[model samples]
Structures are given as C-alpha cells and as structure tokens.
Target: MPIYSSDSDSYDVSSSSTRLFQRERPLHSILGGGRVADVLLWRKKNVSAAILLGLTVIWCLFEVFEYQFLTLLCHIAITVLLFIFIWTNGASLLNRSPPKIPEIILSASAFKQVAVTFHAELNRSLIVLYDIACGKDLTLFLLAIASLWILSVVGTYFSSLNLMYLGFVAIGTIPALYERYEHEVDYLAGKSNRDLRKLYKKFDSKVLNKIPRGPIKQKKSK
Candidate 1:
C-alpha cells in the first residue's frame, strides 16, 4: 500500500518535460542553431550586412528625400553645438586635476613616434618585396599585384553603390554557402587546380620559356 503525493507527480512530469527538451536540442541545432542566431544578431560577417543595410538606408534617404542640404546643416549644427557644450561644460564635468595631453599625444614626440613607425613599416615592405622577388612566392606576388590592378580599374568603372551591393552579397552568402557544401566545393576546387596546373605547364614551355633572357652579369674583382 503506497501513498502517492501530488508534488511527486508534478516532479515526475517536470523531469519528463526536461528530458523531452533535451532530446529536441539536437534537432534545433540541425535546423538552425546558435550560429544562425548569432549571425542574425549581426556577429562577425553579418556586421558587414548591417553596415550595408545602413548605407542603403542613407542612400535611399538622399535619393528619395533630397536630404543633402538638410543633412549637411544637421551635421554642422550638431557638431557646433557639441563643441560649444564641451568647451563650456567639459571642465565642470571632468572636475579633475589639470587635463594636460599625455606625453605620447604631444606634438614632437608623437610625430617622432609616427615617423619611426612609418619607416619601420616601409623597411618591412621592402624586405617583403625582396623576399617575394627572390623566393618561390614570386608568381603569387605577381598574381596579387595584377588582381589589385584589375580591382582598381573595375572599381573606377563601377559606382560606389554597385560595389557596396556586390560586397554585401558576397560577404553575406559566400561563407554560409561554402560552409554548407564544403566537401563538394573542395572537390571542384581540386579538379580546377589540376586543370590550371596542366595549362600553366603547357604555357610556360611553349610561350614563357622561349622569351629572350638578359645577359648574365659577370662579377667584377673587388
């Protein structure tokens, strides 16, 4: 003979419900899970979509409402007002000791630091060029340069809005599609690589190898 309490029945029901939810978790993940949620919330690559959306809105406003002069006026007014407010009340708001600019931000030292950084980066770039010219990455380096030249020329012909749309579409869809069909994509890419390598070898032998070479420089006695 057993006495069954209502609370025990409720506890059993709750436990069963929890187990059911746990079972559905994987189904939820298979459909569209946390990664999709994060993308919808504009994480990482979705940020570009968000920016493109913002630009699209601005372009619409400019085109539809003729907001050019109004936009300029609003910008100027807001900047002036903010500047005045800061100039007038900044001291009281800060209420701290003398607010001198940091030594790093000061004119001469900052300029020197910038100059040094610029020269360091310039030297690094020269070293990279030398390595590319001397090493096996020369073909990749030339391809990159040619790609940049083509991109610049294409960009000059296309309007900013067109380029933005292209970027938005590519950034939004390409990664997700690639992730979804990665194996198939890889298979296709491997096939393409084989074909390209064959073509490259044929071209090098027939066309490039026959190009006239410059006279080799003989080393002079020191």
Candidate 2:
C-alpha cells in the first residue's frame, strides 16, 4: 500500500552511515585506543584498565594499613563463593535450555581444544625463538629479554603485595600516558630506532665483520 521514494531510501542510508561512523570513533579517545585496544578488544580493554586502577588503589590501601591477611581472606572467600555458585546454580542461571552435550564428551573436546591451543602457542614461541636465534631484530630481542630479567630481579626485592600494586599501576598508567602523548612517544621511538640502527651498523663494520672465520673442515671422501 505504501511506496517509498528514492530520496527517502537515500536519506535512510546516509543517516545509518553517519551513525556508524560516529559509533566507530576511536576508543583510545577514552583510553589507549590503537594497538592496545585492538589486542584486547576495546570494551574488555577499558574494563581491564578500570579493574587494574581499582585494584592498584585497593592494594595501596591494604599495604599502607598492613591488612595483608584481610586481603588473603577476602580472596579465598570470593574464590570459594565463585566456585560454589558456578557448580550449583550456573546451569539454571544461564537461562538457556539444558545442553544435550554428554559431559565426558564435552570435557574431552575441551581438553583437545586446550591441547591444540597449547601446541599452536608452543610452535609460535619456538618460531619466535628461532628468529631470535637467527639474529633477526637482535637488538629488540635482547632488549625484551633484558627487560624480563630486570623485572625478575626487581620483583625479588619487593613484597608480593607491593609488586602486584606496581604491576597494576604500571598496566593502568602506562597505556594512558602513551595514549595521551602518542605523537611524542612515536617521535622518540623513531629517533631511537634510527640511532640503534646506526650503532648496529657501526658495530657490524668495526667489530663483527673483523672476527676471523673458523676453519671449515671438508668432508672425507667415502
């Protein structure tokens, strides 16, 4: 009974496109937007950032007030309650018709999936190590290893609570700081890369290339 005009269709399309564009505005505007958001997915990343900040504050309070046992007790209670809830009412609370899956089959499938994921990740890690072994991006690889080693050493000197507090604070603050001063950070990063490359080139020319080659023992004739 009703006829739609071309103009009306075009208007509807344009309005929808405009709404989508507005919706797609970078999440980094509110938090760290780019690669960080991409890796975690934006909403989850924001929630994680919020949790990190909140926990950091709570950790500081606990440390300052010397309520370490209280923190442990709270964590244990929460864990126990979570497990009880999940075991008891979780199925009903899901509000879906009961799954037809056999429990053993489901568990086996889950284990298989976990094994596949573990294998994939192990292979990926080995590939990264192999690349590092081959001296690809050697400087960056060494820097990452050095950073991890330094963190391990530093962590040993701090109490678990203090280390956790620092970890959460760093997680929450660093991304936000980088997001706020992204252009400056990028500029500095670019400059550092250039300097590093120059240094690497100089080292290669003056030192690495000058190393005497080891004598190659030829294979004996059969």
Candidate 3:
C-alpha cells in the first residue's frame, strides 16, 4: 500500500511538471479567472462565438462595406427610435403594453477600476521603454526594435482597424488553442528559447565584446 501511494504521488508530480512553463496554477487563473478569461478560453462557448461574430460583422461593415461610424450610429438610432415610437403609440390602439426599456446606469467604480488598471499598465510599459532606451538590457532593446519594425511593416499593409480586428481574433483563438496543445507548444517554445539564447551569446561574443569603451575616471577626495 505504501509503495502504491508513493507511485501515485510521483505520477502527480510528473504530470504537473510536464505542464507548460510548469505553472503551479491553471491557465484560467493565469488569465485572471474572470469573465474575460472565460470568454477568451471559450469556457462560455456561445458568448465567445457571439462576440467573435459581432466583431467580424463590424469589421466587415467598416472594411468591406466602407461604412462610416457616425452614419451607422445615426441609422441604428433612427431605426430603434422609430420602432419604439410605433410600439408605444400602436400599443394603446391594439390594447397591448409598450416595450419596456431597461435602465443602463453605468457604475463609477467600474470606470475607476478600469482607469486604475490602464494607468498601472501604461506606467509599467513606460518603465520598460525607459529601460530599453537607457540600454539597460540588450535583449529587451533588440526585442523592442524587432517588434516596432514588424508593426511598421504590418501597418504598411493593414489599417489600424484591421490590425485591431486581427488582434481581437488572435486573442479569442490563441489562448484556447494553446491551452489545448500546451505540452507541444511549451516544448517548441523551450527549444526556440534555447536556440535564441545561443544565438544571442554568439552575437555578444563576436560583435558586442569587440566594441571599445572609455575608461571610468575616479572622483578626487576633498
């Protein structure tokens, strides 16, 4: 019985160790375990599908149909108002009740929380950018340059809205796909990371090490 229990414990440990990044927590928890994470991970499949469909429709309207935002907004508002007006007036003659519109009072706390989160993220990004600018981390500097260059190239081919739509689609799909095939993805990622490190070390030795630096001067004691 003791040997069997020990084998079971070993199995559990091995199983967990094999998980992507050897994460102690589940992917949902890593993604905040909130409604947003649920949608992204497709825990609520209907909601996720609806959101993606809505975004695709909007993207099509803007990109394929060349629809203006204000024009679409006004047209929707007009149609809604017309329907509501007809329902309210026609209900009296038809001996029926008018459509009830639900009140949508926005919460101040929700806005405040969103603002705080955005501010924190912005500050964190700025700090990273500052460090990259200061040449504090060579790897980060190269990564920043490469990312910006890629963005520039992509921008030349796609508009801002196209990029946003693509990003949303990626966010909606990538997490779920990764969660499903995490073991394989992690293995590939680990291999690529090791290869990148080797390349970086080689580059550092060949080029960076050859760069000359000025001697540091000592301050005189008063």
lDDT winner: 3
Per-residue lDDT tens digits of candidate 1, residues 91-208? 6677844344467766797698779867986998798677776756644566568888998999998876667667766655665665555445544454444466777789999999
Tell me each candidate's TM-score: 0.44, 0.50, 0.77
Judged by whole-model lDDT over C-alpha atoms, candidate 1 comes out at 0.60
Query: What TM-score number comes out for model 1?
Result: 0.44
lDDT of each structure?
0.60, 0.64, 0.81
Output the lDDT of residue 74, model 1. Answer: 96
lDDT of 2 by residue, 80-140 (tens): 7887667566677777554354687769787997798679869988997788767777886
Query: For this target, which candidate reaches the highest TM-score against the unseen true structure?
Result: 3
Instruction: Report the lDDT tens digits of candidate 3 across residue range 1-222.
Output: 111124322332223345554578889998878898899999999999999999999999999999999999999999999999999999999999998855433667777888987898799879868989898867668878999999999999999999999999999999999987765666555455557788999999999899998999999999
User: Using TM-score as the measure, what is the rank order of every candidate, best first?
Assistant: 3, 2, 1
Give the range of the ten consecutive residues with the poorest summed lDDT in model 2: 12-21
* Per-residue lDDT value at 4 in model 2: 22
Error of 3 at 75 (Å): 0.8
- Which prediction has more favorable TM-score, 2 or 3? 3
Pitting candidate 1 against candidate 2, the one with the higher TM-score is 2
